[model samples]
Target: MKTLMLILAVIVGLALIAGGAILIAINRNGPAVLDTVDRISGGKNNTELLHKQSLGVDPRQKLLVYGERSPDEALPVFIFIHGGSWRSGNPDDYGFIARSIAPEGYIVVLGGYCLRENGRYPAMLQDTAAVTAWVHENITDFGGDPERIVLAGHSAGAYNVAQVALEQRWLEQARVPAQAIRGVVGLAGPYDFYPYDSDSTRAAFGSVGVGAESQPVNHTSSDAPPMLLVHGEQDSLVKPRNTRALAAALEDSGADVETLFLPAMTHNDPLLALANPWRRDPRIFDAVTSFLGQHTALSVPVQAETP
Candidate 1:
């Protein structure tokens, strides 16, 4: 009995310590804490932190590049936008995604957009388009192939990328050619949530006024780029129905689309699977890499042979 009590005490102590650490991380660093946790969980990786710089006056418009390449070697680009319900998060917080995807023969770009004080539907969309446009104009300096740029995001971010790729107007407004976006990878995104009722949806999108125009599902076209939409079967947050609806719309429009409803996965699990060490299972990572390989000129598998 005494031994059992001692073990229980130790377990409780560890739980308290962990809980406190998490609280501190959340309070001090916001969602950037996930980047630190992902790095720790990933153990060791060869991914390099290539650059950290702001593209415009808004601190939220910062960009972080990840991967190793020669001064003039141009590799296909994969840009990931961090999700925080369209109200929070920044590019640096999603380095785990860059670390996971960059080593597979790509230059990974994590982009930030206006949020909280200066964020809303159109503003966020415009910022995302601007990031793509900026990458197209200057990514060559960072060893990225502008013509093969791909867009990806999670949650609210997923909506932003999907809208930018599907709607066309956002990229057009940013002065970026629509074809410049080769493909899209969306993780648990809300593409058809109109008549907003949720706090986040109402807050981020209410200003845009009522209409299906903001929904990505309404913008599918035969000329739309190939897309991969992933969702958790057990997800209650965004719901797998969102993926199904969007995929059906894309398919009906004669657009290339793929859907993965992962069993037992939750809303954030798809994003968590992108962490390096967590990728040992390889299901989510494999799907993303396969889509990227199909669309990009590299056609390389997830595992790039080392020299």
Candidate 2:
């Protein structure tokens, strides 16, 4: 049984975040824009413990939990990572994603990981794995079932989750079973960028010395979990080829992979669709929820027979 929620009393549109004004400027101060939106979203929904550290090893890590939990029932967990070129972004700012999904009968976790001073790729991967492992061990306290966990992320965060799911060592290091991750959802992620040409890519991975080991595309196997790779055909930031290459590799390896290439979407469109007002844009959230449902997370709890 899912926890109860009343969509609250706020109007559902841009006006909700526009502060009684019809026109809001997006080109100005992105932080302020998100702050306004987060505040409104936070109020309308049950945003509790907007921040918390994982079990112990990583303190800089933080996370936010969305949705209420019923004492007698365990819902499958959905863990989401944020995009910031692996250098920027805070969990508090990304609650809109959790807000949109948690209402659909899932315990949505907006997880954050430590980024050391000039930290490279595997460090984030380790923290993400640790967070996932910790959630698996302890989310029962929050009414989440450990056996059914789905991972999703956007851009750099997308790369993080996808890589963590594809590569065995990171989760293995954290002592989490690979099968615990039921599926992966990546939005505008760079899965095959090896040369490291862009400033963001070069800074986070250039020190890695041009290796495919850090790339998720090279790690596909027949045993790989199902994946939904979404990219904007119009995305100039990371390019749609990243998703294409990874999907092709997974297909060749006899793995289950699906893709949504939005011809009109930019890098941020898929992400924006997860927030209020834009959630009805279609394909992104619908495809993800549908994919995750095919796994263990979306079904109704099995009721034990009375003797």
Q: Judged by TM-score, which candidate is best?
A: 1
lDDT of residue 274 for candidate 2: 74
**Reference-based TM-score of each model:** 0.86, 0.83
lDDT (10s digit) by residue, model 1, range 1-307 = 9999999999999999996896577556644766787778776677788788786788998888888857446889999998888877877778878878887889998989998657776888888998898889988887889999999999999999999999888898888887778899999999988878798888788765746788999999999999999999998889888899999999999999998889999888788778644577788999999999989875547887799
Candidate number with greatest lDDT: 1
Model 2 agreement with the true structure over 229-271: per-residue lDDT tens digits = 9998999989999999999999999999999999999888788
Deviation in angstroms for 117 in model 2? 3.2
Residue 145: error of model 1 in Å? Answer: 0.5
lDDT of each: 0.86, 0.79
Off by over 4 Å in 2: 1-32, 38-47, 54-60, 116-118, 208-210, 297-307
- Candidate 1 lDDT score relative to the true structure: 0.86
Q: lDDT score, residue 96, model 1? A: 79
